[model samples]
Target: MALPAASVQLYSLAKEFTADPQGSLDRLAAIGLKNVEAFDFVRRPAEIRSALDASGLVSPTGHAPLLTDELWTPDGSIPTPAPEVVFEAAAAIGIQTVIDPFVAPERWLTEEGVADIAERLNSAAEKAATFGLNVGYHNHAQEFVASFGDHTAYERFVSLTDERVQLELDLFWALTGGQDVPALVSRLGDRLTAVHVKDGIVPASNPWAPGAEAFGSDSLDQRHAGTGEVPLAAALRAGSAIQYAVIEYDRAPGDVFADIEASLGFLREGGFVA
Candidate 1:
């Protein structure tokens, strides 16, 4: 199979990017990246598009909230925008697939909740098509916290969502949830269009599990790709139709740009991306 293209989630350098969008993107371009996965871009699509264009980079996929009333992060919650609004913004930024980055942990714990999440994303996908865009979902460890009989909530979610909805799995989070990362990638098969190339020491416990204390990105022990515990190479190899291997860090281990470069180096040296 052909290798996927290397991309970075702009969230990896959110602070720097927020401070200097164009300069940050230019630095990524200097590192030889041709593609990026935008984050929190719905509010300023035109500015981001201009920056990406100036940097000679393209954002084929981006993150936005679609299935939730309000988007939650470890830090705070952002009010969710309407799907039509999201699609319009994504199209403006040249994003082909708008992926919802998170759904609350409690929402992934039951049959009905998982079904609702899938149904909402499926509907969003239909609406997004009108704007010449597609919609997808990204998972955190929360998706694996509950199972209905033999299937994980994540598995059931995949089965419920339409084919048009894509999946972007975070390998480190999957491992944190006690999954065999490469095996899950194989099962996801062609639908897995992207993988978050994040590597880190697995947290001692599932932080999203019920009763766990609140935590933020600063608490993560993330490392450059292949330097941590995640089976990134095996997971990348297992993907049958992966198109973008996106490097991300909830928290960078060092200078953010250098950290991103190190992960990009891993992808290049390991022959995981084109």
Candidate 2:
């Protein structure tokens, strides 16, 4: 397969992007990036699309909540919009896939819960197609905390979902969940279309585990890609059909732009992305 394209999650520079969408996108373009993965874009699709156009960037994939009533984040929860609304916004922003970025830990703890999650996503996938788009899920550590018959909740959910429901694995979080990251990537194979290429010193324990203390993104020691614990190069190499190697940082170690540039440099020097 051809090497995946390099993209950055706009959430990596959330504050800056929120403050000046056009200027921030321009800076990313100057850094030689041609694509971005949008975050929280449902409310401002036209503005983001305009900014992307001005900067000669395109957002082929973006994050939005799809399978839940409320979207969970490290910081807090945000109300979810209807699936149709999400697809309309994504289409407006020229996004080809709308990825649900997170689900609560509790929901992944039981076989029934995992099935429900898959069912909802499969239903969302059907709805998404009407708008000429696709739907996917992005994982954190929560999905790994539970298992059924030797398969992780993450894996089980994968098996249960429709073939059209894509997957985006977050490397650092997979490591945090004590997974063999590259092996998981290899197993995911073609269904894995995108990856959040984040690197960081993983937390001592699964923060999303039951009874774990609450933590926020600011508390994480996220670093530039290939500079921390995640086996990014191996993971990227293991993917059979990954189309986007997306750089992201839950918390940048320094200036966000410079941090993003450093990660992008890793992708280029390693020939991991086109």
Candidate 3:
């Protein structure tokens, strides 16, 4: 299947956006990006829309807490009011899919816990639906490793979540968890709605945990999509169900814009986009 034009994952350009969101977005658009996904956007809705209209960029995906404690005052508790506010903000900004990237502690692990998460996700999806939005979950390596009962967290999530709730498959982390990207997508079927296109070259010493100072920095040596070891073509084949393919590299060599340019060039040559 032919892929859509690549979308920029704004987390890769978080620094730039923080400094000057409108200008940064315009520059990204000038560089041939017409779509984007963001964890948090600095611009207001009107500002974002104006910039996008000028740049011809569309933002379809958003990231926020699913049921995290941070939104609430206390630690490890979900606040009733915050979800509504978050939902409204995303909907206002023209975000079609709002993703909860992590499972809160109370909703993590155990069969019952998995079921609870499914129920919560379903509720969020229902709420989002009223505003013409879809709710989804994005996975990291942890989801594949975090097991509950007979199934891994990813398995449980796919099994228990309602059909309406979708998934944003982070391919690099899926690989890090020792799962085949296409195989997992095939198994999940239509529930897989989006993807994070990232790659890495981990040291052989500890492929999953490369250094002692901070595992976060080394677990995956974030790099441009096609520059690392990920089998890009095979993964895209598996991602037949996806609509938006988001490029994200948590860390880049040299300047960030250059890194993004390199990634886009690689994808264009590979025929993922025109």
Where model 1 places Cα greater than 4 Å from the true spot, the runs are none
Clashes of 1: 0
Q: Per-residue CA lDDT of candidate 2, range 1-274, in tens?
A: 8999999999888889989999999999999999999999999999999999999999999999998888877767788889888999999999999999998899999999999999999999999999999999999999999999999999999999999999999999999998999999999999999999999899999999999998999899998888889999999999999999999998999999999999999999999999
Tens-digit lDDT string for candidate 3 (1-274): 5565688788777778868877888888878888888655422566666666677777888777765545321113333336677778777777888888656433444567777778888898888888888899887665654576666777987887789898888887777766777778778777787877777773333222223232444244677778787776677777656787778776766577778878887777877664
Off by over 4 Å in 3: 42-44, 71-81, 104-107, 148-150, 202-214, 217-220
lDDT of each: 0.94, 0.94, 0.71
Tell me the RMSD of model 3 versus the true structure.
4.2
Query: Could you tell which candidate, 1 or 2, scores higher by lDDT?
Result: 2
State candidate 2's TM-score: 0.99
Tell me the TM-score of each prediction against the true structure: 0.99, 0.99, 0.85
Query: Who is ahead in TM-score, 2 or 3?
Result: 2
Candidate achieving the largest lDDT = 2
